[model samples]
Target: MYTRLGVVEYPEIDTHRTTRLFTTDFNNTFILFLQLICFSGSLTKSSLLEAVRMLATYRVHRLPVIDPISLDPVGVLTPKRILRFLWHHGQDIFQPSHCIKTPKQLNIGTWKGIHVVYPHTPLIDCLDILLNMGVSSVPVVEHLTLRVIDAYCRCDAMNIAMQNEDFKLKINVKQALEFKTFATDRACAVIVSEAESFYKVICKLVETNVHRAFIINCSSVIRGIVSISDVMKAVVLEPGSHLNSYCISHRRFAEFLFETPTMETQAEEVDNEDTKTSCTSRSSSRTLS
Candidate 1:
């Protein structure tokens, strides 16, 4: 099913514009700044497996499901919705379930080359790291201990749009985490232990409604991160049980899941080799998709 509408992104919107302009009256006219010529990746009546693969490959959070005849978006697909569906129906689908295995056994998530930020890191600098590194979130660590205290996510960046310009310039990562733009904004890092079952990980992600969770050791040092994309990949792409029949019969199910209003459907599709290299290199890292 489509999880979101269509995907359009403004990669050039810097921290300044995201903070000052998003909440201003000019927000309505902000679409003018978007590059209209960009051709984003899209799907047309594809299989669930294909959707899952595309989502992981492109490192996108959502993709539009286009009506073949009208070329208008019928729905959007997202990793979270896919996981939710799997969480409910996974037992019926998989033979000899992989869900019970640990992420280490399944070889899921990112383990190496994780980009992290210290609590004292400038908020703008942290934002820059997110944008430059093309990562959805970064663990905020204590400088001396290297222990994860919190996280700075793309969702947190949205809160910056509601803050004053001076607040944006002066705040550090710790301060950013403490400041609440809305009542629901005060979220800590979602974490899972390395020894935890994959089922428990899914439970954590679905329960928290977060995209990814940092995998920590006994000391709470981040070892890896498992994203909804990784979870989807483990189930849908796992070596052979019985998916062909299910995938064939579930087109309507997919449609119903992905179907939603077509208003806010913009996501970025990175095509450059550099981006591919980055994504491939940091395969264990969390992506918005």
Candidate 2:
């Protein structure tokens, strides 16, 4: 059985603050986000593929895998991980029908040891982890048990970069919290359980207008992450699946403000600076391999 997650209430966008933060400087602060739905663990390959279609349509980056009984998240999936998996395991997906027989046909264990950060970490420091690490997002987990808590993604990085000039000197995740910047609400993350089929997860992703869904086990413990990239790779391997037909293609809500070339350039430069960070060289080999 699959669980259908929905947006109970709409997220109120602080357009004025977001605009000012992008336009001016530290003079402005605060970003608000709402909660989202979850998917089940029992999702099959078709359902997984569908989830990817939904993500492509919605332009979401991550998928949280959830448990059936406990409903806890087990893993977080991303496009890069999916691409890497497909690159490593080409034989299984390229069958006669160009289709996956089951969700287990693909190996999902690759993301189990991905890097993560604590919720209390400073925003600048977190940005350092993401930019230098080349990973799209980082999950906030309990240090002792590695249990999932929250996430910080490229979208979040872009938000901070917008204020780079004003906040260039010093800032932390806690400071962003003090000002209510970004959607810190766990509700914004979409959840999925192991029992749900891939098709159901995909439908939920589209129905809820979210970018990613969380996958969890019975104890609500995270097992693996899934993303649109993962699903698209499935479609690409299967042929004639036509993933783009699912949802409308548009810029993500997080990217609404940076339409101009200058802003775009600034954003790219901010992201690229991670390369020069002290940690990039040290971790690049490990992260890529």
Candidate 3:
């Protein structure tokens, strides 16, 4: 049988309780049966820059943009969507010289106190880290060399749930990495050298469809991590020269953000509504059983 994923918004459910439930019972359950916690935060009549900042600050992939008064989800914003939007419109606003600088020179991304996991670390521990650290993924490094061998991400949990009963949380990081070869959708560690241009790093992230890239030195020791948020900050919120130029360019961006939904977005909304209905029906059936 194939597993299907669905989304439902439960505003009354406690996020802390939901987290505790996952951490304690994750190994014994199917992910589809679990109720996803409500979004940690939401936007109401907010600016595009604010939305970008919120996504970066929270280290979450997406946030629901809600109606201020009704508190209903109007749209969902994600890093990938934001990046794609910027890529299309950035050429007109972003200076070529600024975009070409190295991430090191631009001082983008987390340079100090980076989090990592070892090959022998338990998969449960890694999930805990993702929960507590508010990051999507952590590099899995070799114990002796401290070299990044792979990544452990939030999506890996779903992949594990979809696998045969042999897969369990008791597995180590190394074992978890083995599953990536079979699950094509799993996010693998994307490593880049510190000297690579900022633009190149953006291209890598977009092409690979990953949230972050590890920046390593000659010996492959990680120096920092570059995330999509960091890229957005660098392009739109850069310290001095680019700020004024971006302000003028952001008008068009703001207009784009508030424009009527396209056919694609409408379709997505309909799909989400259908999924919510389906999930509700399934939940009720299980309760009766």
- Winning model by TM-score: 1
Please write out the lDDT profile of model 2 over residues 118-221, one tens digit for every residue: 55555655666667765566666555555566666776665544563454313445455444356555354465775665554544555554445566667665
RMSD to the true structure for each prediction, in A, is 12.3, 17.2, 12.6
Candidate 3 C-alpha error for residue 206, in Å: 1.6
The backbone clash count of each candidate, in order, is 18, 57, 0
Model 3, C-alpha of 254: deviation from truth (Å): 22
Candidate 3 wrong stretches, greater than 4 Å:
1-47, 57-59, 66-74, 160-167, 180-183, 237-289
Candidate 3: residue 247 Cα off by (Å): 16
* Overall local distance difference test of candidate 3: 0.63
Measured with C-alpha atoms, the lDDT of residue 168 in candidate 3 is 60
Compared with the true structure, what per-residue lDDT tens digits does model 3 show for residues 233-258? 77765533332212122333333333
List the candidate numbers ranked by TM-score, top first: 1, 3, 2
lDDT of 2 at 87: 40
Residues 1-289, candidate 1: write the lDDT tens digits: 0011122343432333321222222322333322110111234534667677666666778766655445456777788888888778766654344457788777888887788888777676777767887788888877766677888888888776676655544467788877867646445789899989877887899899888898988998788889887777776766433555222233443343345334223212222324554444344233221
The total number of steric clashes, by the backbone 3 Å criterion, in model 1 comes to 18
Per-residue lDDT, model 1, residue 3, is: 13
